[model samples]
Target: MTATRLASVVLVLLTLCSTAVPDVARAETWEAVISATSPDGLGTATVHYQHLAAGDSPTAEEINDHIDAEANRAVTQAMWDGSTRRPWTFDASGRLTTWAITVSEVFTGVYNTAEPHMPMNRLGSVVCDTRSGIIISWDNLFSDKTAGLTRLGEQLETQVAAVASPTELRTWRRSGQFAPVDVNFKYWIPTREGVALQIPEVQFGRGLKVVIVPWSAISDLIAPEFLPITG
Candidate 1:
């Protein structure tokens, strides 16, 4: 072949090779489980968390590290801090659009037990974007924060009242947890069925109450990009 034709063919092959390779900057996650004990033999930390399985983007790496660190932090607080709490479950789910992480810890020891009669369980979670790794804020999830929060609050109250006793409902309403505010609804995780809103023991006189607000209920209120949140 002529030198010019040969060079052209070589350039074409190189372009195809590059195009066939996966993008290193694409963010992907892998879940890892570890059962570890503190060095001082005080307690144990068995946590399930996410890691940057495939991605080189700075944002993705940072978010992955943050997620890992947060999970480790929760376990560490229980172990080294003399809390004697055991993580019953540390579960997480991810899709092409979103990632959700949740941890449920049970208090076994007497330390920091305010209400001995009440349940000794705590729930926590973190949700973020899959690509940019930016933590999904309340503002990002809802298009109109005020209206969205009001709707969420209404749904939460309706769901809780359905199962809770009249007295329990009175206590829940007095607690002001279901108010249209971001701080009130902290423990929430995205699920395939809907967004699972958690009402911990502290907020409700009863034990933990999880209410799944179906996507259909607030489909229009949700941001367009976050529509059909898989998990």
Candidate 2:
């Protein structure tokens, strides 16, 4: 073959080789389960959490570490803490506070996809402590907790107002619920799109209202621990 033709072929091969190779930054994640359980008023309180190891984005491990720590804490507290003092099934008065005590990890997207080195895979957990139940707010997941909460609260007002009916909005305002300035937003879950704020069942006699807040809306306020919550 002519030198010129051979040179062109070699260049094309090099380009193909480079394109086929995956970036080093993207780590392969092998899924692992970490669980802990403790006795509860009913049967038992269990925390079965998922951990992403050897996956993309060096920060995956750091985020999983946070998940593990928080999960373990919830189980431990439910087991030893005053959780049983007021049981969900029945309290000292023999009145049922709740049906059961169950805690589960609600991973974002409702599943764990740690591979491919994506941004922060935010985690939210719900520990059914019975009486009032246990919630791991988005604020608790970060360091600048107050600031994060403030932003989350403020954003929720707009989101909530857009969907609330006139009657519902009035009820919220008159009932001192969803305060505009104080955003006492509590109880959140990770959704496929963003963080979902669960309006307590006690508030409106139902939990049909869920204020879905995107991470971009409060990214600036999040702490370094769980910052850059982008996928």
Candidate 3:
């Protein structure tokens, strides 16, 4: 072969080889069972999670690490020092079949003759069906003392749709008897690390009345531990 033709052939072969080779192989998904121990050492809770994509299962250890990272980011940004405990079980389809006993704490300031500060304890549970990517049930227990106060409040179910990489629109409503009051909340997910959740833009009631609030106004009330996951 001519030298010029041989050089062209070698260049073409190199280009094809480079194109065929991937820089990084895709990671396989695995199901993960995470058990969180409470900071007080009083209890532990477990949760099962898997990647949303099909044929992806992450190990329990990986899931636990991801949960810890997100939870830490959430709490730190909200300026709260709290932890959670839970145990979760997953089915073969990568759905969470059971979850139990997740507790959190916060500092509360009570006004009497003077400002008295106290630590408040709160407990909650998040149950979900991992296969369907649906949360089945949840409950919250609060330590506030009042006459005839109902510890359990409204049960809420949310359906979320990602409109963009950084924006998600959600339809949420209270389950059971409170179903009549449906609302829409829009979340702007952070594109960078260390930023917390923004104040959700709420369209309240069936009539869809829009209300906007500052992120700081509800930052303390929002759960900092859970952030949106992109599939």
Best by lDDT: 1
Cα RMSD for candidate 2? 20.4
Tell me how far the alpha carbon of residue 77 in candidate 3 is from the true structure, in angstroms, after superposition.
11
Q: Write the per-residue lDDT of candidate 2 for residues 1-231, one digit (tens) a residue.
A: 334322221100001111221322222223333332224323133333343332343444444454455554443333443233333211110001111221223432111122332221222344222112233345445467666666676676676677768888777767766553323454555544566675544454333356788867766665554443333
Report lDDT (Cα) of residue 45, candidate 3: 32
lDDT of 1 by residue, 191-218 (tens): 6677778666667654676788887788
Return the candidate ranking by TM-score, descending. 1, 2, 3
* Model 3 local distance difference test score: 0.23
Return the lDDT, model 3, position 138.
Answer: 18
Instruction: Write one digit per residue (lDDT tens) for candidate 3, span 113-221.
Output: 1112212221112222233333321111112212101111111122122221222222232222213211111111211221121222123222112122323332333
RMSD (CA, Å), candidate 1 to true, equals 14.7
The C-alpha TM-scores of every prediction are: 0.62, 0.43, 0.20
Which stretches in model 2 have alpha-carbon errors above 4 Å?
Answer: 1-42, 54-60, 80-151, 162-167, 174-176, 180-183, 186-205, 214-231
Candidate 3 Cα misplacement greater than 4 A, ranges = 1-27, 51-68, 71-231
What are the C-alpha RMSDs, in order, of all predicted structures?
14.7, 20.4, 23.1
Judging by TM-score, tell me the better candidate of 2 and 3: 2
What's the lDDT for candidate 2? 0.41
- Name the better of 1 and 2 by TM-score: 1
Better of 2 and 3 by lDDT: 2
